[model samples]
Target: MFKRNIFICLFLALVISCGGDGKEMISLHPMQEKMAYADHETIMLELNEVSGLNHHMPKSLLIIHQYLNNETTSGFITNDLSVLTTDKVQISTINDSSILILEPSNNRLIQYDIEINSYEIISDQGRGPGDLYFAEELSTFNDKAFVGMQGFQLSIFDCSMDLCVYEKTINTDFNNYSIDATEDQIYVLGISPFGNPQDSDPLNSDHNLFHILNYQGDVLNSFHPAYDDRSPLVRNRLSSGGMIKTYSNKSLILIAFDFFPYLYEYEAGGDLTNIFQIDNFVQPIYESKESLHSGFSAGLIYGNKTVIDLTTRVDDEWLFLRLYERRNIGFDHVNVTFTGDEWYTYLAYNVERRELYKLGDDIKTTPGDSRVLHVLDQGIMVNNDGKLKYITR
Candidate 1:
């Protein structure tokens, strides 16, 4: 039955790629290197100017960008103490004072008051908030925030009152690398330390794991799908890591490792209902694009190969998939952009249709020479640069 289901999925995917009525079609131009996909009425945020702030820049900075309606804004946090960095920096409604700024460079979790521009240190525990989500399931009835930790745990913050309260911890065996939450449930993804400890070997037994937990902190379900061991026709084995996204009602989507290009969809009960496998469509005749910069590669991984990061948009209709390809010794980074529209389609980097649109003019070098630009509703964010910047979109 599983083999039959897999065959059917492959056939349907091929048909969908061939212009099936149910699938959305995207085409890429040869000159255009990266392409951003969105709904027909998608709002485009063009870069205006990099904003200047009077605050002091810290050694380590993290900016969270948020966009709503016509307003775009960002919150800035840094590890430097010489300067009094606001716990929250409001891009819009600066006078309205809807932004909260947190302080204490060493605190793991900080709470902010947007209206007063005040923030309080919530918890010094855990590895800080790597990924945060406002819980819909628990929020409707109570005030709560979900924080995923790099130390393999989830921290719940009770926000029902004026001052948010830090709750206890829910422990899991897997390293909780990334997290996302909907109203009723939280989604966590992590790598198995015992399986794939070494970075060089791709064949490590570490299986990408996903967990679904309810507001009561109950383990609803756990998923660990087997990676495809078959070698790709061209590329080396692909490894999977990074954030997982869930919908308001508890629907889930996650990326998997192994060069096969796999995206899995699971139910709230933790049952795997559908799987999308991306096949590298090869052309019989092809020419290599000249590299402008060399020697630079995506820094996240060791090899010269590219690494991918996936984030879902607010609408939950489209997935923002960014590909970072490292150049040779002296070259800059090359980023190829792609989006997966349907629920069951895996994103492929070289797939012409999924490439990201180039910025300004077409300039080709290596991956390291250039950076990937992201335009949120509020401002512009650049990936290659170490710190996140927010500007008018």
Candidate 2:
């Protein structure tokens, strides 16, 4: 009887080991924290008063930045019969007239021009544009037109004429880092999620370090610390990710983690400092009964000012908040500055009038499912049926 029991136990252990190796299990660590918001709250803000007020641009200019089935592709509308696949994950606008799209699947970057009422594919460069940035302060080497691709290569394009002049391509392995450049230097934020083995382990370093690269793709300095390492919280299980911004000759790096849904601010070249936490300003409306996994949805920085929109969910309720940072005094935590209380604040462009509004609330006229394409100018583009609509305050 003992021999039979031992054989059965050994067989069970072998089966369990095999199951654990092949299957991925997501476990949420439960905490005794209370829910932030118990009931619904209404917050209203005017749209035009914010600094970067988002007005409906031309429909043709709205490009669908999509990662379908892990494949990167671009199209005008959902059913417009226009679909082009490239090296996946390259989606950015070149200028007001052209959209620089990247397909990482095919390792190609294509420029699409919008003239009159039609879309035309202009150039097909077999490379990946890592990330796209606009504004003068975020451009290193004084290149009016620029695109950063994978393999740490940045292509400076001349957009004055119809044909783009590929001035140069600099190669480096920043580890799939996202680029945000200033006149003097380019800031690349490394995104090493848990799923990617090649990326650095956050728990080991306790901070996500960003490389400050020069115009020639040379590493100048490293900035931005991981939230997990800086925070006083114990054994925190937060995933760190953020958007890089350069303004007033300073780099504004916004980092957020899931363990504690708070936004940490840091100045680019300065000692990695924590300027402000989002929770200090905007109170969380809903706290997850399980575990809250929060992350910054989108962000934009212009001049000495910065704006970030964050998304968090607790239980079945979804929460969104817009935080603003002005010239010198870090982030403004005044609740009255924006809206009082609201169920959801999708994005905030203008803060003077507290322009906080929800996206996809209008379904009757805008007939389509609301899908968040990509965040730009603190505004989100939702696919309304076959058309793209911008949701902003």
Model 1 bad stretches (over 4 Å): 1-107, 110-121, 125-143, 160-164, 190-208, 226-240, 249-252, 256-260, 273-303, 331-388
lDDT of 1: 0.35
The digit string of per-residue lDDT tens for model 1 on 1-393 reads 122111222112211133333333221111111101101122122222213311421111102212211223334322211223322221111112121122223324445343344556555532445323321111111255555554556667666667666676676665565566666777776444432455324433334356777766676776754233221111111222444545443354544332223445456556655544333311111111112232111212222333343343323333344433333324224644322211111121111122221112212343224334343333333433223233341
lDDT of 2 at 320: 34
Which lDDT values do the candidates have, in the order given? 0.35, 0.35
Error of 1 at 290 (Å): 37
Per-prediction tally of clashes: 44, 22
TM-score of every candidate relative to the true structure: 0.46, 0.46
Off by over 4 Å in 2: 1-93, 103-108, 117-156, 191-203, 206-208, 227-241, 249-260, 270-345, 349-370, 373-393
